[model samples]
Target: MAKNKGSSRKGLMLVVLLLVLALGAGGANLYVLWSQSGKTQASELEDMPAAEPVPEPPHYVALEPFTVNLQSSQYDDRLLYVVITLGVADEQSKQQIEDYRPHLRSRLLMLLGEQEDEALLASGGRQALAEKVLALFDEPFAERLTAPQVKEVLFTEFVIQ
Candidate 1:
């Protein structure tokens, strides 16, 4: 009976030892796989290209309101009231616009004087006028090599009467 008991105890000890070894091996394999996956994710992130930087918003230079007498033969009393805002490329361009404000205003008055009320009141006329204004400022200020970067001509207010 003692011999049978001793043999049974040894058998149980062997089964327990085998179970512990299997559990340890399984845990080690899981750890290695987890670490390898983490490294792969990190390497993939490093291989990816950097994201693009966001562009800056456009700078603006607002001109005071302009009131001009429109060209009309029949009515002889047509008028146009407009407020313009210039979208400049940079601070230097904005300063240039400011520096030449008076000359610009004079040129604008002359251009505005030639537009008929009917034409200005028509569809897309305001846009056409804006383009013309942009062209007027596209030239270089003074003797500078680069032109004043006037990107857009926006009309905040327009009235033809």
Candidate 2:
């Protein structure tokens, strides 16, 4: 009987200890959450740059023109310079593109920025790149516009920079 009592006391003590430890851990987590809760997210947002407004679709042709300078990766003398002009057919499509101009610009910049200098080595590569850009412009609003509406992607001035 004494041994049984001792075993029961030990078990009780163990349970109490476990409960205390669990409460302490939970309290610590709650404290951390409470302290962080007061920190304003708006201040963090204010530190970041404001997003650029999407240019509205223009009634007239608002030529979204771009020029990029890329050095040749294959040969030191080989360089690529390209100027592209995109002709949007209507105001709705124009507005859509304008609304997405910032995104479009970023995509174009990234594509151009990552171009291998060797990509300019051959005419085929340049043509391929032009096609890629054309495809990219159309991809963003593919569902929004019909085939005929997504009319033209023209490369005005293409030269080896």
Candidate 3:
């Protein structure tokens, strides 16, 4: 009789534990559903105003590769060999770049020559240099073109020695 009672008690305990776990799982599911119910309706959001169209970026020509001098420190003696690509946005810009190629080349060469030895060592330094080159297309060269013509400056080859 005592053995039978003990078996029944163990079975009841197992049932209680199972019930508690099931209730916990059910509560968690209910909480998740309750939290998600407050979100905005997707169908209503679809009725908002349409977005404006983005203008297409102009295309330009890539120039030939060239080498430029770079300033260096005692620890690292380095010379930079850079291959540059020029973007000519319009006919005027093209003409201007052609007309002033000597001046532009001289300025670029000077700019590159003044760069720090560690400048090329940084990850984003090339991008910064590209931006600087693009800025030149906008300033004095603006009058010759309808707009600032050069869109990008690509470095095909960059070596530090």
Per-residue lDDT tens digits for candidate 2, residues 1-161, read: 99999999999999999999999999999998877765656577888899999975634333445555565545655444556666666766667776666776777777876677666555587777767776775455446554323455566766655
lDDT of 3 by residue, 1-161 (tens): 99999999999999999999999999999998876764445545676777779755655555555566577666545688887877666666767677767767877888788887677688888888888888765557335444447767888888887
Instruction: Output the worst ten-in-a-row residue range by lDDT, candidate 3.
Output: 139-148
TM-score of each: 0.71, 0.44, 0.54
What TM-score does candidate 3 get on C-alpha atoms? Answer: 0.54
Q: List ranges where model 1 is wrong by over 4 Å.
A: 1-38, 47-49
Which of the predicted structures, 2 or 3, would earn the higher lDDT when compared with the native?
3
* lDDT at position 63, candidate 1: 90
Stretches > 4 Å off in candidate 2:
1-80, 141-149
By lDDT, rank the candidates, best first: 1, 3, 2
- Residue pairs clashing in model 1 are none
Models, CA RMSD each: 4.3, 17.5, 15.6
> Best candidate per TM-score, number?
1
Query: Model 1: per-residue lDDT, tens digit, 1-161?
Result: 99999999999999999999999999999999999999999999999998889887889998999999998867969889999988989988888778888878888999998898877777988888888888887676667447789888888998887
Clashes of 2: 6
